[model samples]
Target: MAPSFYETLVERNKQYAETHNPAPTIAEQMALGRVFETTLVITCVDFRLNPDQFLQTKPEDQFLISRNPAGRVGPALQEIMLFDVFLGLKRVIVIHHTDCGGSQFKDADIREAHKSRLPDHSEIDHMVFGAFDEVEQSVRDDLHLLKTSPYVPKRISDQSLGFVYDIKTGLLTPVE
Candidate 1:
């Protein structure tokens, strides 16, 4: 039998641990001072968009990333707040992309699909999947979300930026 995905991940991790030099542990970050010199990347879960490649991030780069289906900041606010409180975030980069699956459907479409697929699960009727109409507008909206959020500090919020990663061109264009 083939190894499960989880088993493959574990085997890969074992190989990774052998050669990779990781960034500072959370304890190291805490001992260093109040703010960590880390930039946080909020990008899509799209398979083609790798922040490491696009951002030119080396292992030593102090960048942390949090990814969701569409890279929507609304659902990731708690994560931002928690990371800021604990590890400290020097910057927040929101990167939505062209050809994004998140922009492909509306809430109604998913809700209807769910109802059709799982008719008995009435609780799935009102679920919000963070679907957005436009990709650039979504990035702008996420930047606004980070800026206006009370839980995210002014220092961090001020440094927040947005971008639209072009999958076809393999480029990142800043989103206003």
Candidate 2:
């Protein structure tokens, strides 16, 4: 048989480590305690929507990225608060994408699916799967939540933005 998954991953990682060469400016900025210059991005865990390409910027060392099912910030409240209060990050970019898997099901659909799969576990009721019916509305709702959250600093909250990424067109539309 071929190499196991972990073995393949290790081999690939070794290749990556040997070839990877980050910019010297990024290193210099890090040494001077200046890394990212702008907002934190909260986006879907979808494989299609790569933030660097969508934002048209290299985000490796220049952004604080948070990925969730629907790109909802509600589940990442603690991290967001810490970044805002201690790290001095003053803005947030919430990006929800078109045709996301998270938008394919409703809460009730998820609940029933879970019940069918595991008949004994009734606690799945307490889970909010963060499914979205409309992508833009989901972006708006998440933005509103972040702006109103007491945990988030006022400066960051005021500057928070929302967008919907179109996977087919590679276009980002502001959700307002």
lDDT of 2 by residue, 1-176 (tens): 99999999999999999979766675686797774555688998888878877777764445678898888889978888777666568688899998999878788888899899998888987889889888888988988898788888777888889999899999989988
lDDT of each: 0.86, 0.83
RMSD (CA, Å), candidate 2 to true, equals 3.0
Candidate 1 off by > 4 Å: 1-18, 22-24, 28-35, 117-123
**TM-score for each prediction?**
0.81, 0.83
Q: Provide backbone clash counts, one per model.
A: 0, 0
Model 1 has an lDDT value of 0.86
Please report how far candidate 1 places residue 116 from its true position, in Å. Answer: 4.0
Candidate 2: list runs displaced more than 4 Å.
Answer: 22-38, 59-61, 116-122
- lDDT tens digits, residue span 1-176, model 1: 99999999999999989997766876776697635567889888889888888889864567888889889988888888878876657889999999999988888888998899899998998798989989899999989999998988999989998999999998889987
Best by lDDT: 1
Candidate 1, 146: how far from true, in Å?
Answer: 1.7
